[model samples]
Target: MSSTKKVKDSHTIMTQLIMPNDTNHLGNLMGGVMMRWMDIVCALSAMRHCNTPVVTAAVDHISFQQPIDLGSMITLEGFVTRTFRTSLEVFVEVYSEDLKGTKTKCNDAFFTFVSLDEDTKRPSKAPGIIPESKREKELFEGALRRRDLRLIMAGRMDPKSADHLKKIFS
Candidate 1:
């Protein structure tokens, strides 16, 4: 790992064509299929940031804003939003592209992954993310709030202790 790295350093993008096998009977891409793609892209971003193998710890706040039809092109972009010890939070955005038209955001998700050491198979330190653009900085800050929410939801943290979340919900 280097001494410093930017969020752009770990950016990852993947594109897939929705096919019959990836869709439901309604001719729309299945939620599970989209989730799988999200996981893969996010994990790759985390790994790129840490320079090590990573494992998905949690996925939070997956929002499906639009339906992707079969035969449509789907693009998934991911980047590191923040880091916590051995864990890194990855933000992913999915876009649906039309044949003779533009691309629209169809889904967004946040994923957490823990870096792993190859030989020791233990949690390893991950590189810190240096947010560059305004959007990246905003997402970087939001990741901490989302992490607290995930911890509270998983019974690992108390609701009252999550100040960021309390500010919003309370």
Candidate 2:
């Protein structure tokens, strides 16, 4: 991997058509189905950054803003927000499109994945990411706080020790 790479270097996009199997009785896409799509797109972004296979470590703050109707077109875009030693966080935004081609943001989430070594099957170093655009910079900065929150929620980190989070509430 290079010393660092741009956010666009790991950008990933996916589109899916909502079908009966992917929907609930209400004809809206099932939350689990949406989550599965999010995971796939995010993993792609992570793998692009690391140049190695990656596994989902955690997913946080999944917001379902709108329901995707049956037969509607849905697009999910994911990019690496930041990369650490052997893991990275991806921001995925899901949009629902109508027949008229109008799109509405339906869901969004942050996913963390660990890069893996093919031979040893252990965590491996991941390339760092550089934010170029304003939105990318913002997400890159906030990634640390979001990662801290995930760790706290998972009982892997103490809330008091989250310096990035402290700055927000303080």
Candidate 3:
């Protein structure tokens, strides 16, 4: 919860070329397709951080604030927010860029990934924090917030909704 404990320097930036096949009847990239790309971008960051294969544990939240048209350039940025014994929380931002170099934020989401020991096919510990900059700290702190939000959304903090929460959260 403290700012000093957060790490913020780590980041991953990627650009994707949208194709006709990724579009819907409306000529815009499908939301599902974008989400899949987001997952890949986030996973790449997690793997680079841990130096191991990672599997998606959960996606905390996804908001499609803007539509991305086919043939537009898609930019994705991802970074580590936090790490547990075997899991890492990553935040991803999606943007659509135009030929004139202007960019629009399309979506932002938090995803949790668990590092896996490929040989054992089981959860494994991630690398230790070596944050060297203020950005890393901010990212770590943000990840903490995302984790809390996920718990709250799952109804873990609501007593009255406990039953409904368990069925879904579990």
Best by lDDT: 2
As a whole number from 0 to 100, the lDDT of residue 45 in candidate 3 is 84
> Over the stretch 22-138, how does candidate 1's per-residue lDDT look in tens digits?
999899999999999999999999888998889999989776789889989999999999898888899999999999868999979889999999789899888777999999999
* Per-residue lDDT over 113-138 for candidate 3, one digit per residue giving the tens place of the 0 to 100 score: 98899799799887656555677676
Clashes of 2: 0
Clashing pairs in 2: none
| lDDT of each residue in 56-102, candidate 2, tens digit only | 99988777788889999999999999987888999999999999999
Candidate 3: worst-modelled 10 consecutive residues by lDDT: 1-10
Considering TM-score, where higher is better, how would the candidates rank from best to worst? Answer: 2, 1, 3
- lDDT (CA) per prediction: 0.89, 0.90, 0.77
TM-scores, all models, native as reference: 0.93, 0.96, 0.79
Model 3 steric clash total: 8
Cα lDDT for residue 73, candidate 1: 98
Pairs in steric clash, model 3 = 6-137, 7-136, 7-137, 8-135, 8-136, 8-137, 9-135, 9-136
- Candidate 1 ranges beyond 4 A from true positions: 167-170
Model 1: pairs clashing at backbone N, Cα or C within 3 Å: none
> Higher lDDT: candidate 1 or 3?
1
* Top TM-score prediction, candidate number: 2
The reply for model 2, stretches above 4 Å from the true place, is: none
